[model samples]
Target: MGAVTRLFELAAGADRLGLAVTRIGLVVVLVWIGGLKVYHYEADGIAPFVANSPVMSFFYADPANYKAHMNPEGAVVPANRAWHEMNRTYPFALGLGSVIVLYGLLIALHPVLPQAATVGSFLVAVMSVVTLSFLVTTPECWVPDRGGPEHGFPLLSGAGRLVVKDAIMAGAALVTMADSAKAFLRRRARRTPAEVPSAGAVAA
Candidate 1:
């Protein structure tokens, strides 16, 4: 029983390091995935999600027409590629990727710049919220009925499974934000001067 309690204490002691590692892990995910968006296949892969999003559709020249030009992963359909070029799909993806990478880098400075990490973690949380909405707004998140009884609600397609994992990131972002905010306050407090009680207050 004493040894078990010691193990629990050890885990508690490592919590701060765990949070720091988690921040780095999230940075790795954002940088790698965001960097991939600059590639043809990666940009093409995200079209369905972007086109289906009402909030994002404005970036495309003709969001409604995207379905007809849908290309599978690594597919090199000239016609579809041309259509995407017209829609500025690649450009939009590149810009979004830059923003994602920037956020990751901002969070990476958590140790010395808690203020930046707070802002970055907040942005990540907002981004995750938008991503999670894809499950509702994007039909492709669920398996389409091709005469299969296992299609639709409660049945996640591969994309849906991937999007759902953003929930963890969202939660982690909040945790990181809170930690950074607390750290910022601690720094501020250290720099602040202590208040001295007036004589009347001291007498009370």
Candidate 2:
């Protein structure tokens, strides 16, 4: 084959590997971030996002007290600790971590259990969309200080940058889902028999 033809062949052959790698990369991200959520600091950092979310705010025991315990100024007082405990942040984080870990594991098992992987991919896609929505729902996504150079509607804060990255994850999940679904259909096709030609037609 010509070099160009050989390159095209190689690219075609790499599709499965590329999908596998994408799945693995997503698994790593989910597990790593989910694991971090189990810690106090990580959970605390996400408090603003969760609190501002109408769908998720109910998870906290005292959503209104989120800022009180955050101690944004780095002052660790009794009130801070009390508010953190009262908010039930740890339990919520743990629950979210558990679900994310499960999703990662399911995606990792795609080779053996593609159906589960498809389900996991679907869940990841949903989660990604929800995370991306934080950019719109959370005021903290944009710089708060009008005096700062970066402060503006178009200028994203650190949290906004983090949320924006979820767009890639959402795209990845969609690709993985499509790949898994194709595999599922192919598997089903193999299990069913194709129709045989009639004897009269074969004679012709």
Candidate 3:
């Protein structure tokens, strides 16, 4: 069969549409989280959601300042109290957020849809790992006060729901990755014998 025909055949059978749908969904999630980060930086409303607790305080404090330091240029800025807090606990959020945005745009616009999805899936897998780790470490909600008369203990609570959600997100990412990988390998397999030249030809 012709190369173009074979290429189409290889790509035609896999769940490309499903992959695209999930990829777009993943992008939406990324964009949401990215916006959250931006809000934490720019708006003060996010403070209450994460205020006065050791676990989530940094989330409320100067979010923009926090995000600013995460950029490549922001790397050199001396670490202060806010940067130290968020960077220490949720260190991957900034880089992962930026990557997600880029991946989303590429998948949405790239001419090579298959390749974009494949690469985007891999990046989403990385994000899933980070999300899973956060789910493991932090509780969803803590007592607003550190040392109230009711119970002075540094209570950690509500981690279960967040964990479940994050687990779902991670699973979605894994499925997306698997679908993309299958598409890639199927395309590779459809290559003609001449396309898979000997090692000598590859070297030459």
Among these predictions, the greatest lDDT belongs to: 1
Model number with the top TM-score? 1
RMSD in angstroms, candidate 1? 2.1
Clash pairs, candidate 1, are none
Write model 1 residue lDDT over 123-142, tens digit each, in one string.
99999999999999999899
Sort the candidates on TM-score, descending order. Answer: 1, 2, 3
Per-residue lDDT of 80-169 in model 3, one digit per residue for the tens? 434535443234335445665776665444334656766776676665565455433433333335465542124444543343465666
If scored against the real structure, what TM-score would every candidate get? Answer: 0.93, 0.85, 0.48
lDDT values, one for every candidate: 0.92, 0.85, 0.53
Candidate 2 is scored at a TM of: 0.85
Candidate 1 vs candidate 3: which has greater lDDT?
A: 1
- Give candidate 1 regions above 4 Å deviation: 196-204
Model 2 lDDT, residue 198, Cα: 98
Once superposed on the true structure, which residue ranges of model 2 sit more than 4 Å away at CA?
A: 1-13, 71-78, 195-204
lDDT of residue 37 for candidate 2: 76
- lDDT of model 1 at residue 25? 86
